[model samples]
Target: MCSHYEAVNKPERLKQAFQVAMPEGAKADVWPGYTGLFIRRPKEPPQEEGVAPWREAMVGSFGLIPHWAKDTTVCKRTYNARSETVATKPSYRDAWRLGRRCIIPAEAFYEPDWRSGRAVPTRIARSDGQPMGIAGIWTGWRAPDGTIIRSMSMLTVNADEHPLMRNFHRQEDEKRMVVILEETDYDSWLDERNAEPRTLLKQFDPARLTASV
Candidate 1:
């Protein structure tokens, strides 16, 4: 599960790569509680036909805050949601059911390698050096003061059989990796009508990934 990552902070890069206008001041490094950028369909869709599906970038807390949560502390454990149980898990089910799908653009993500008897922080990025478009879900939570807080969580799938992803985490723990979306599926994955976005939650191509300690 991804709890730490290097966010794509350059506005021009975001605009060019994801075609969304990301606001300035996005943090370069993001952790569970850090505020980061996410790309999703605009709250109001364009009425004109023939126009491409529009996307907008917004800032949100990295950890998902359920509507029922009293505070933001829950973000510590909600950064990554298991795809298999997301539809039923209390923290993620609502977002999934409501189709709050999003894309998290990251320069790279960190994972732990324990094969050497001690944890080694490994940086994982695309072999081509482009930013990664990670599959995620987002939601809005109202605070006691009536302030709306947007938060998101990355989706992960079982990676026990993946050639590259299976090397991360502990030797005994069940292996898991985040769902990296293909460039071609970005618009489709955000379609609210796509009731089965869960089908896109699969391990990314190992050949397209590069890992360094």
Candidate 2:
């Protein structure tokens, strides 16, 4: 999965790239060397009609937390959701069916592969050098003291036999990659009216995308 990414551009640049206004007080987070649009629930969801507005503290990092978890540590292990099983997995089933759906914006992401027994890191982004929208799911957890924590996870699907991705995903294992969406699919993917998995999955197309280092 896309464990590392980059959004080196400033928040204003991201806004200009995506053609969306920056939310008030929204700032860039570049810690861990992975920069991208960082959002909290109830505040960042889309405000347009048919678009699901982001929550202020409802969407945190790209990791998911099941509502039943006793603590937040589980989030560390859920940075991605496998599309093949997300619709049925216990931790994600309910959320995928009822709760939160979001988009994570990124200029590019990093993936590592073993080259001659040494790890080689490569950066992947659109060949056209445009921004990408990664599909995600969000969850809200309430602490004992009533502090609520919101988190999210990127969704991954089998990578196509693209030249670049093929080098990293060599096994039949459910190799994960971010769910990249096209501009025309954004509204439908965010529509509350189209919550069904089949409907949402139909909006993704790997053919239109190209990846490179």
Q: Considering every candidate listed, which one attains the maximal lDDT?
A: 1
lDDT by candidate, in order shown: 0.90, 0.60
Off-target runs (Cα >4 Å) in candidate 1 are 45-53
Q: Candidate 2, which segments miss by more than 4 Å at Cα? A: 23-59, 169-174, 195-213
Q: Using alpha carbons, what is the TM-score of model 2?
A: 0.75
Which tens-of-lDDT digit does each residue in 73-119 have in candidate 1? 99999999999999899999999999999999999999999989998
What clash pairs does model 1 have?
none
Candidate number of the best TM-score: 1
